[model samples]
Target: MDRERVVEWLEGGSVSIPKVLLKHYADIGLNEIEFLTLLHIHESIGSGNPFPTPIEISNRMSIDGTACSEVLRSLMKRGFLAIEQQDVSMMICEKYSLRPLWQKLASLMFETVHEEEEQERERSETDLYTMFEKEFGRPLSPFECETLSMWIDQDDHEPVIIKAALREAVMSGKLNFRYIDRILFEWKKNGVKTIEQARNQSRKFRQHQQPKQGVSSNEGTRKTTIPFFNWLEQ
Candidate 1:
């Protein structure tokens, strides 16, 4: 809400963090400053640029440039922030949220990160639902619809990923509950239910198979090429 609330949340020490933000802190531990640095970047730019320069962010936050640089480096190492510099200004994107974790540590320090989305988002979600149903040729049950909606609403998954998962389930002769579950599981594991990931996985599997086959064939050829008696004599 306000600047004070935002800073408080970042400082509040919490063990359990939000799933979104957990990604950042999961590897290396993050402190109040590191957390605030991420929030500062988010306030400056909401997922606009994947990476921003430490100097720009420091200037905006009015903190020491050296301190900002150190924090940025820490964030990068911890996987909380990514860095990309162009000819012009450096861009930054908040990969995770520290608010949820802040709530756990101290509600007083908890601050909401995302403000409510614009009306256009709501309308777009409705349209996307309609399109999805039309494409599926069946009105999904309430539970199924909700699942799909959440997947769509949460920018985590792209529509293409869901479609790809569905397609893979169908083609694998597993167009059943088990198949769908497997697809979702894979999606969760790799955060990629997209067709591209699926195709890449498929390619990798084929490559793996080819190598095994090649190895087997080579062994067979080698066995034939040399006689057992010759080997014993040597």
Candidate 2:
């Protein structure tokens, strides 16, 4: 590799713009010419030239100065651009203000983040059924599907609560929907809304049953704490 070529390539400079702009340029009704113009303006601003002429912008784009000026005017009218006068060294100077564009871009960025989170949440919710089926080692029937949906929609149970209930059912050697539903019902009745609350309740319930339970092996019999919640008793 040639070092001078590398440095020269780096010296060609770069422009920084939000990823949201690339993904959602159409959302703001900006055509290729308009977007490219904005990029040039952004680059010029970054280079400390706040007031770049149409000729300067056009030199970097396919359009001429007249077309560039028209595009700039259009952007200003569309509420995506503004111009401001500022005192530089005791002399008033006109400069381009991209505050409106930045504001809109920021709004679009937030909207995209929210949209991505919603998509991820939906994916997790849909995966709950698959998790249950994998645990049970069988396909869920339509009635079972309806029951799960009822727990989520009608009962207003979050996925975490339902999953905790499922864990209880599995750990208790009672891998059935009824037992899971009973656990969830009891948790709801006792205000076990969060996963931590459910865990505390489970631990206390197991502790309460610890004294009365023992394990028998071929070697001997010994008293041991039950690790699973006895939801059947509740």
- Each model's lDDT comes to 0.56, 0.87
Give every collision pair in model 2.
none
Report per-prediction Cα RMSD to one decimal: 22.6, 5.3
Candidate 1 residue 183 C-alpha distance from true site, Å: 1.3
Q: Residue 232: error of model 2 in Å?
A: 5.6
Residue range with the least summed lDDT across 10 consecutive positions in model 2: 206-215
Backbone clashes, candidate 2: 0
Give the Å shift of residue 52 in candidate 1. 37
Candidate 2: tens digits of C-alpha lDDT, residues 1-234: 999999999998888788878777778788888888888888898999999999999999888999999999999999888999999999999999889988888888898899998898678678889889999999999999999999989998988789888888878899999899999999898999999999898887877654556667875888756466667777
Q: Which candidate is the best by TM-score?
A: 2
**Residue range 142-180, candidate 1, lDDT tens digits:** 887777766766635655666665666555545443455
Candidate 1 segments whose C-alpha is farther than 4 A from its true place: 1-136, 153-155, 176-178, 191-194, 206-234
Q: All candidates' TM-scores?
A: 0.31, 0.66
**Residue 72 displacement (Å), model 2:** 1.2
